[model samples]
Target: MMIPRMLRCSVLLFLILAVTSCVHTPPLYVNLSQHNPIIDDYKALTNAGLAQRCCPEFPLKDGWLGGDGDVSVPLDATTTLFLFSDSYVGQQNQTKRNVPGTKIIANTVAIQSCKWEDESEINYFWNRMYTSNPRPVFEPKKHGNKFWVNDAFLLEGKLYVLLEEIGEKENAAPDDVFNFTQVGYTMAKIDNPYDTPLTWNIDYLPLPGFQHPQTGISCLTRHKEYVYFFINNNDRVQQLVRKAVTDFEDMDHGFEYFARDRSWQSGIETADMDTLFTGFRCTTVKYHSAVKKWVMIKDIQFKTNEIKMRCSPELTGPWSEERVVYTIPETTPGNEHYHENNFCYLPRECTQNYNSKSCEMVMTYDVNNFDLSYVINHELIYTPRVITIYLPVEESGGPEE
Candidate 1:
């Protein structure tokens, strides 16, 4: 049968559409193994070298703190680490005395150095906080001279630092400890952080609603309109996720809880957290543009705790269930301790110039001298090892595949 030209064209189009509908997009199987980390422990600093001894001159009568506590934010081409340390009074079999509040010792290092071996090259922007806060600020006599700053971020080229302050009491009983812990915010402008100004635009905000008061432990990152804070609420599950609605640079805006009505564990997974729905931090690179995915690393605590990672298509996720990407070596007694670990992605070329689907990650976390105390005690601490994990080259799609 001879068909009209228009009718024949229509029939051919229909057949083509039918075949296209049946074809499935090939899954993107990224070969993560091909990419290797630049090296392990590019710049390793131990407590023995960084820790300051307990002395009467300092706030703590007999105490020490390891400078491992830092929050880093990437600026221009370098990563600025806001170093935080606190001194404690109680040392050995004795009642606790007054301690130094969180004091800031500012420093900046190129993110690239994080992949190389040069400790001396790194610059410490010390007493930079004193410059950030130009006001002749002095702690009230009751609280003593102590400040605890943790978890810092940079937004719009301005440094946003968060800290907690503890207060003391006078004419009070020996056993009576005044419960005074407040979260404060401060800002600094790094025209050239190498030549860091000696003052900051400092301010304090009240710490609210807690069975046990906590401190910020890790770097906070921006996801869309929200800033995510990773904290330890002084409980079994030491790490808790919190959020602030405004941009980190805006001091006027206060933080609102993620899911006001729900509890931590149950509420987060179920999407009850908030309207700005997303979860991240704990892992180094939360938002990776190459893969178009958000990676979340959770620290689970039991008798012996471990770290794990999960991925989602978007920052606000219906997250893929966590996979045990790596486990801390249980070779020694109680190897897994605190929740602090590191994760960083290899540059794109390392993945052979692959697109988002062909991306790869290379991460390193220090297991030796896992904490500041390792230095304070003057102990030959564990040699924190850096472990690199390569995700398989197959696309991770749909949970439990």
Candidate 2:
């Protein structure tokens, strides 16, 4: 029963189309919540009152607070601490009482603690808000400080915080030539987060060989026995580099880069590292045990006002394509504050919800814009927002299977 050649070819083409249709999965829908309690509370305190305080007085000006660092460390099941950079406190436009001419209120690393009996009952406490005396967790040397904390990871009951030392002028254009002289990290005891004049153990580590002069370590993640540093290179590509968990503190050795061919190699040469994903900055990757996958939430550099989610089966992986999980109306082009940059950064603590089938992730972004309208008329928009995302369930007996 030999079929005619054209008929056979047509039948094969139809079969292939059917299989492809069945195997192709549609993009996951991101569910933005109608009500974000955190933002609501912020609005109530800052916008609804005659006083008009954008944030609490403890961390930033008149409470006109906003900053970019999203490194979070979970101390226990119910307690978490969030770290901030370029935090301002006191009057929005006031000179530091001590530094005569300097208008910067506070050039320090600020922290906020979130305590919860359960997921639904979380309470946030600023370091200085409710206390008789308030202070920043980590203070910088002076105004226009170049060093700022970027990301952190917990190991052996200690927190390792990565501090990026910038050799460029403050507020330089994104494309400006910024020099990264050295990449250093510091450590603090997990239990001593609130120590005044906090004691920190500092050390410097050589940048990964593949790192470009403009590249910086955006985030850190732990998988199996290694700690992976996600590098944001000048070309807007994300590179994955790793160091054995045991040698993390050693820094002089045991570091390797994921090469283009997907193999681990012991060098930092730009040519040796592989590009795991592109257009990612300020990312957080955590393992989802329930689904046995690594889930990453990050800011898409190429896509303004958009935050994306990616999943992978391995640490250094064939990561899933970026899915737009959330977008900010304020940062969109033509919007009132469109000129200002916005980022949706996921803290490492948010990974607690990763295993849940239905999970809500809270992300933070800067709400400041140089636009006159935003500075004078806008309500306090600098705060964290919550977004709910559901991981896709695997269907049984797929066409490929």
Candidate 3:
């Protein structure tokens, strides 16, 4: 169950980068004027504000020290549920987790009440094997496998969590993040999300044909009657698929693929669709009322200190090329705590905190290195670091993600 939590890269951006191969039409960057915006397009283009957000360190408890995969689901205007993966639970010595007997669990979760407000509180959850041994809250049923969380959304008071079951890859070095492969896509249906996750009534759903393709819970979004899923393939081709909102009970059936002709197709027709990664991309996709387009925030792969964005008029689109919006100052030399191994990752947007009037949105990412030795000394390395981005309001929405 040692999933290194590295598979959650923003594959959506990577796959979206390969759009020309699958799309049949020309650029979908519809005319800006025709799209309709709340403000003049020129004035709306304000510079983004980037800075680190608080806690500087993770609030650790006996079973929750620090972890990665901080994808959040805003349950209400003031409440949010954060999903974490490959958690460092069990123990810590001051800021370091290298204390004796410290253990790393597959996953954990946190509930933030009054989020974005001064009174907010974050509480992490896990199950106890007895008194001392803690296990992941959503433990996988498959033997020798672990559950790593993906994006989740609330529908009709229920929480639907996207998960990928992973198992160790043969002969991988202990520190290798790529030492595991996805077992398949799984759905965790929580009946009472408001209650403590420990008391949650959850059902583990093994998605039908989970092995047909290596689809990570990269992202799950909804529009009108259909909920869309972005599928990732290791070849770099991304496929958009949808199922009716009413078909939640029969999730295994009724899935329709977005075809090159803009029609929804089904069955073997999707067999030929392209993909770019073996795991889900955990990219946060949300509509910015100010910009009037869905925006995805991510840290550039290999270009660690930079944060960038890509947008599309529609999910199945001719996505705009990435634009680097911010550069992390920590990676720059001469900063108080700069390291050659300090790389940024897991960039995700906080949609509830978005202010349409100011056209500003909050975002977070984690900084880490491959060396556990370095991480042990930097207690805050795995905690979520924050930033703010602003978009230029357009005359109308011709195209954006």
What's the C-alpha lDDT at position 123 in model 1?
28
Better of 2 and 3 by lDDT: 3
Q: Check candidate 2 and list the clashing pairs.
A: 55-63, 60-88, 60-89, 61-64, 209-268, 210-268
**Can you give the TM-score per candidate against the true fold?**
0.47, 0.63, 0.77
Q: Give the alpha carbon lDDT tens digit for every residue of 190-262 in model 3.
A: 8677776777889887776545244434676766677777765542456677777687757668877776666
Worst 10 residues of 2 by lDDT: 13-22
Show where candidate 1 strays beyond 4 Å: 1-65, 78-82, 86-120, 128-149, 164-194, 197-219, 229-285, 300-305, 334-386, 391-393, 396-401
Candidate with top lDDT is: 3
Sort order, TM-score high to low: 3, 2, 1
Better of 2 and 3 by TM-score: 3
Q: Flag regions of model 3 displaced more than 4 Å.
A: 1-58, 61-63, 91-96, 115-117, 210-217, 271-282, 330-336, 396-401
Candidate 1 matches the true fold with a TM-score of: 0.47
> How many residue pairs clash in each candidate at the backbone level?
16, 6, 19
Per-residue lDDT of candidate 2, residues 111-226 (tens digit)? 32222121122222233542334344443344333555666656654556666544445566765423224333333223333332134343445343333344467777776677
Misplaced by over 4 Å in model 2 are: 1-64, 91-144, 170-215, 333-349, 353-357, 372-379, 395-401
Which prediction has the highest TM-score against the true structure? 3
